[model samples]
Structures are given as C-alpha cells and as structure tokens.
Target: MSATQFFKISLKRSTIGLAPDYRAAARTLGLHRSHQTVYRPADSTTAGLILKLKELVKVENVASIPTSVEINAARKAARGYQVVEKQGAFTKI
Candidate 1:
C-alpha cells in the first residue's frame, strides 16, 4: 500500500480583527490559539483552507502523524543528569 501524507500547520499570527470568514477558516483548520500546531490530511479541501488562511499559518508536508505520547515527549524538556562516580565510589561530604 502507498503511504499517506499530511500537513503540519502552525498558527503564526493572531486572528483578532480579521474577517469572520477567515476566522471561521482557522477554526475549521482546528487552530484554537496562536502558536498552536495541528495536522490535517493532505488533500484539496485542506489545501483550500490553508490557502484561505495562508497569511496566518505556516504549513509543511509530513510523512505521518505523530502519536500524542510522541508529541508530548517532543515538547518535554530534556533531563540533565550525570554519573560523576560509580556505585563503588561512595563518599560523604
């Protein structure tokens, strides 16, 4: 089977003071707040919506959708840790 593709859209601008139709298009694109990212199937209908809100969002092609767990992991801060000494080298201050 052929692999499916999707579009990763990020809201780069605000919707305030914009036309109602444009705002509606943003909502239809599943964008709720500024800087939010969403994925949609790569199709003509989605393309049309992206075109309508081209000025407010950024779009890119992605091979597949990431799971919620993966997305959360990607957004999480990295843990900084180091083993200065091995277990045999226990010391008291």
Candidate 2:
C-alpha cells in the first residue's frame, strides 16, 4: 500500500483584524494561534482552505504524521549546557 501524505500547516501570521472568513478558515484548519502547527490530509477540501489562508500560513508536504514525542522534541528548547568530560576522584581541577 502507498503511504498517505499530509500537509504540515503552520500559522505564520495572526488572523486578527482580518476578515471573519479568514479567521474561520484558520480555525477550520485547527490553527488557533500564531506559530501553531497542524497536520491535515492532502485533499481538495483542505487544499481549498489552505489556499484561502495561504498568505497567513506556511505549508509543507510531509510523507507521514509525526508522533507526539517527535512534536514535543521539535518544540523543546535546547539544553543550555553540555558535558565535556568526567573527572576522576584523584584528578585536580
């Protein structure tokens, strides 16, 4: 069987001050806030909605959907420190 494709849609701009239709389109795509990302099937209906909000969103074609863990990892901040080496008890700084 062939793998399903998805549209990785991220809201790059806010819908505020825009037409109600644009805001509704964003909501229909599950985007409630800026920078929020959502995955939807690559179909005509979704395509139309995306096209309507194209100016306010960023779209990418992904082969598969990401798991919650993967999504969380992507959104997680980098660790501030890295361990270079471990010191032995007899070693002096």
Clash count per candidate: 0, 0
Question: Model 1 TM-score?
Answer: 0.78
lDDT of 1 at 81: 82
lDDT of 1: 0.92
**Candidate 2 per-residue C-alpha lDDT over 1-93 given as tens digits, one digit per residue, 9 for 90 to 100:** 126589999999999899999999999999999999999999999999999998999999889999999888998899898889997689656
Error of 1 at 52 (Å): 1.1
Model 2 compared with the native: what TM-score? 0.76
The models' CA-based lDDT, in order, is 0.92, 0.92
> Which portions of model 2 show Cα errors greater than 4 Å?
1-4, 76-93
Q: Alpha-carbon error at 84 in model 2, in Å?
A: 9.4
Error of 2 at 19 (Å): 0.8
List pairs with backbone clashes in candidate 1: none
